[model samples]
Target: MKNKSLTFRIFINTFLVGTLIYFVCAFMFFGNLYTYFEEQLFNELESESIFLEDYVLNGDLLKLQNLETKNRITLIHSNGSVYFDNTVSFEEMENHALRSEFLGAKDKGVSKVSRYSSTMTEKTLYFAKLLSNGDVLRISCNQHSVWVLVLGMSQILLLILVIAVIISGISASWISQKIVHPLNSINLDEPESSDVYEELKPFTKRIAEENFEKAQREEIRAQYTANVSHELKTPLTSISGFAEILMQGGTDPKITVDFSKSIYDEAQRMTTLVNDIIKLSKLDEKSIAMEKEALSLRSICREVMEVLSASAKTKNLSLNLEGDSGLINGVEPVIYEMIYNLVDNAIKYNKIDGSVNIKIQEIQNFAGDRNKVILSVSDTGIGIPYSERERIFERFYRIDKSRSRSLGGTGLGLSIVKHASKYHNASMLVTSEEGKGSTFTVVFEI
Candidate 1:
């Protein structure tokens, strides 16, 4: 569907409203003018009737015959006979006894009435008075009806309407332009800084926020690409050098076996790195469609301990599991991976004879409602520095790069933990003191 221009809509609305108002005012003005004219005509007729009444009373009726007037004059006898008429012969005129004006004047001394012609194009006003001599005096005048008056002045009215239309069109166009100019001038690059209408502030603010997020995402992508390239290149270089040594002949069998093992170790490191990258990508894109189910956090912690028991033993670290069997709804694999990474990191970074304590428990609010299930891994190890804690969850971000690589730490473990916790609608909190211990906590809403 095609969108219509805002300016066009505004103009049409303005023009229609102005035109309607104009017509309404014009109708009211003309209607009042017609009424005023009728009233004036009646007053004149009343004055004339008063002046001629004395002449009839003095028996000087013949003198009224010479009176010059545009109005029609009539004198009627008490018995309903028309004795005198200025515009028509009295003998041919109809009797005035049955007339409303004449009958009203006989009863009330004075009266007036208006009558319209059959075509309604003409009107006649009649004023009648009762005389002292048992006779009635009547005066009348012809007038154009309100419709006829309007028709007579139609040209002037039409000219005024045309002028109003032209003025309205100009005003509408100016108003529409004034309203739209601000919107067109907005700068999208700095939408929030643009001087825009107050109503449009929220719209501009949203755009600004989206632009900021887009820039951050672009920066992160570039950094991630660089990190992936460097990480892959290191393992590939070591494997290539070791494989070349093995291919050479006439070497000691024991040395050959050692070189081949070195090549295998590098390949295994590369495989782990590739797998971690794929998992992070899937979590980021939300492509993992695993269904959620009820699972115990303590059970998952025990499984992780079993898998890393040998690694813990090698470090002379004691792995302990305590607290309640915290149960939550989540994907099993994601939950297991997150716990496994946390425990493995704890064992790797712990001091000899130091403990890696894993705890799972459900916490309740003051209202006695279960609020969240918490899984915490606390290690008595060389802890993280406060400044480096924030960056630990970033991929390929290692606090001690040389030591991390020597311990077979991929540096993506915490990043994976972060993504998995987020997938389960969980939050992570870290608290540590250098050279003492560190604790990582994941809180899941129940």
Candidate 2:
């Protein structure tokens, strides 16, 4: 119903209102017109009665009997006998003293009365006046009631209503168009400058905002495509060049071992990159099935630390754990992945013999209703610059691209941590300074 055009709705509403008004006016007009016509008939009868009384005073009884008129005239004696009647014989007519109009005239000098005939088709109005000679002169006429009059004019009234409906329809359509024209003319691309109703300003502004956001998303998508193509091409070229060298029979025993090892490393790096891309894609699309439950943050952190202990040992770094049991409700696999990535990044970017400290403690939440678990990985390594801290969580964004590639870093580790944190409804806070150390803390609501 809301999808209907404004013109159609307006036309229907106006037509219905017009019909209602027409009925009301018709009822009132017919009623008042009938009453006015009855009053005028009574006045005419009264004047004729007065004239007959004058003729009787002048002894012109013969003229009363021969009066040429449509109305019926009657003359009554003071003793209640009918002396003369124009429409009927005086001997056959009933006595006039008991008549309502005659009795009214005896008391008031002049009066009128109306009654419907037995057939109910005609109504008779009787007006009577008292003469100076102690006689009553009466005049009567027949008229119709308001309802009968209305029935006779019904066809003409119906025709008028039909004409009114057509006019109302055209007027309603014009009004609806005038009201909607401003809305139709608005330019969505430049909503601020468009001439529109004040009530519609918010809607137009929202459209403009959404268009800008869509454009930004498209730009980001284009940049991501180019980055993915370049990243994949680099490893493919390395593998191809090494295979060509081996095919040419360039075999120095020591160099052959080195080339084969380099080829294997490149293959492994590409595999890792592909896997990370797939994982990021699943996280981005929110397709990863999550079964939430209470999990021990301390245990997950300890398990990740044990797995990376050998890698830390190669650089002679101390991987230590602090604090106690920290419980939070989250998907176990996601929690495990988040911890593993943070710990891995800490170890990978740390200087040799540097210490990596993992802390699991509970603190009062911002709302102060319950305790929230805080898992932090702090490292004594080359810290990030303040300006680059925020961008580090973006996929494939690296502050030092050449050094990051040399270290076999895919640059998606921190991005995964960010996505996991969001999925778990946690917050990631990083504090780092150049040439010093950095701390990455994740606060999870319990």
Candidate 3:
């Protein structure tokens, strides 16, 4: 019971207050009734006195002499000696001096009230008046009627208060539910705003804000996971391929020499993959501080193509730059790595004699506040499937696992391209489809 809810407590308090209020009303009502009963007793005593006086004035003494038996009337002599007993002899009982009405009536013939007096066996009220003949007429009546009336009224009041409290408790609980129900149903993780109570507006707004912040954090985490997997898979692929090559040692003498030479190629590929992945990881973690330098964007692209030209020739793909661009503020190696990855992926995945097209153009972005450098790499090869266009950049994700492994392609290439672009405040985008070819685009802030 002590563990009950706040609303339950409120209801209980309301009910108790209602019960108290009901009892207070009952007490006041009974108090008024008791006063009325006192008044009626006084009136009855006065009326009886008047009747007795009239009978005496008309000189009829014996007419209601036996009335003392029914009304508890006692006639006393002038000498303070009782002349009639009715129930007992005067000598057998104590003097009624403690009664106020007895003294008042004895001294002044006045009708008066009494102190509560009791017999050896019964409790009773005592009333008295003095006679003109120097005698005292006293009366005592049972208090049974008053006590019964009070007790019966109290019982009824108790019953009514109990019922009222139960009803009030139920109503209070219902009111509590009306306020708490809506709060229990709200979802704090989704991205939506809905109307709630005005008093609860602050809480609702806080929930919405937290949900939005949480969504942003989750998005960042997902991007990191995608970026990291691709980053790691690239180096692992080169290392594994080269290790496999070195294991088939000393075959045909020509084959043995060729395999040994090829090991160097694989090792360098692994080295490039590792360094790029680390750089991207640092950038993704925002732990790398880039020192921007002035360099021509066109010259950077051409230099990167020259380094990758031999790989393109081996794959029988044509790699060329189509436009010239002025100097851009960026770190040279970082820019070289970004362009190289994009150009390399294009050639590596191209069909025999496929062409890798590099284009650089200045364009206006939606913000309309600055010139943008758009670097696009388009290739003619096995194009991306429409469904896999967006997923191609995730780490370790390969459309054709066996073919990618055979080609010694590290799945992290495009992922590094993505992170490198982001590190340089660039926007990377892709357009592709199955059996046609693919184009990768980067928008660099200029």
Candidate 4:
């Protein structure tokens, strides 16, 4: 799980940082080793020069020669002559008196290191401290011992840093895998309860919620379409029926007038049904959203009455808006249709002196999340049969088929109301008894 691509990058990065820091620190630290060797050589030269001070002051050549062979030393005189040269002759060298060791002996009063000879590749440490007889000591070696030891240790440390980089890279792979593996399976469509990393829990919950909402929306849309199509068939059938009758017309004036009136009525019914269908479809598809502009429900009721009052007067029925109006979030066209259908149905099926009372009020619903604007149209008319009240919203369903046909009903009015409420995300409830008339309530959510 941990050995993922992300780990590889982490390992490489760590290795690089570690290696660079080590190199800088090691170089500075190892420099002290070289300095230590230089100090050792200089101290040895000082000791030898002091030992020879007593011997050289007495002009003891034999004692100096014995000491020089043991210490790898050489002696140079004040005039630049090699009296006892164990490493190289002074005159054979390149201007030893002009070199650092010679200058230190004369001026700085301390030891100095200088190159002795190219063939030997030796480094010499010179101590110019005066002997009792005034001679100098020069000790020389190749520094081969210090170089070999330090280089071997450096190689070991380099090997360790390389190993560290490798180990860290392996660990990095593990951590990267832990993060990215879960994300890669994001679109797997697994259930929320399925095994998943803790980090991905919120995402899984959201996906499930979206899927649930999608399914619910599709179900609602299907029901609305089926209901709308069923209702339109009544008017469509009427139009088709009359058109066939006209095609077979015999020349009876009374029959001609009656058939012509029927055809004209069916055609208008089909037109109304189609227009309402289109309007509801747009609302359902979300192409039309409710406009929140403030408008008086009471005023709209009067306007609806003005448009419909003549038809009511034809049957001597009274239509009135009985309650104070309220503002609602809805497109004007939808509200018009909603109110129109309820009142139209009432009037179409009412008695000679039937009355429709339009009552508007604000009420809180079950969820208490929103305030609903309700429009109730109650009629005193020939009411729905108790057994058929539920079927009224179904398309083309009419309780009194003969009477409804005579009144030029399209059978699509109630269905339009049902779909319109659904499109608005509202609800509709119907109540009626055989002789007590009906009330259709339109509940609109804000």
List RMSD in Å for every model shown. Answer: 3.8, 4.5, 13.2, 10.5
TM of each candidate vs. truth? 0.84, 0.78, 0.47, 0.51
Better of 1 and 4 by TM-score: 1
- Candidate 3 — what's its lDDT? 0.71
**lDDT of every predicted structure (CA atoms):** 0.91, 0.86, 0.71, 0.70
Winner of 1 and 2 under lDDT: 1
Q: Which pairs clash in model 3?
A: 229-395, 230-395, 230-412
lDDT of 1 at 202: 96
Best by TM-score: 1
Q: Using TM-score as the measure, what is the rank order of every candidate, best first?
A: 1, 2, 4, 3
How much is the lDDT of residue 157 in candidate 3?
61
In angstroms, the error of model 3 at 398 is 2.0
CA deviation > 4 Å runs, candidate 2: 1-7, 28-32, 35-39, 42-142, 172-198, 363-371
Candidate 1 weakest ten by summed lDDT: 361-370
Off by over 4 Å in 4: 1-158, 186-194, 198-202, 223-245, 248-256, 285-292, 311-316, 323-331, 348-352, 360-376, 381-446
The count of residue-pair clashes in candidate 3 stands at 3
Task: Tell me the tens digit of each residue's lDDT in model 3 across 276-344.
Answer: 567667667775677889877788888989998998898788887877584567878878877887887
- Tens digit per residue, CA lDDT, model 2, 142-255: 897666787789899889888877777777777778877887788888887898888988898899899899899899888878887888889889989987898788599787
Give one digit per residue, the lDDT tens place, for model 4 in 259-358: 7787787778778767866765665567555664666667777788888898899889988787667677666776677778788888887888879899
lDDT, model 2: 0.86
Count the clashes in each prediction.
0, 0, 3, 8
Q: Quote the lDDT for 21 in model 1.
A: 90
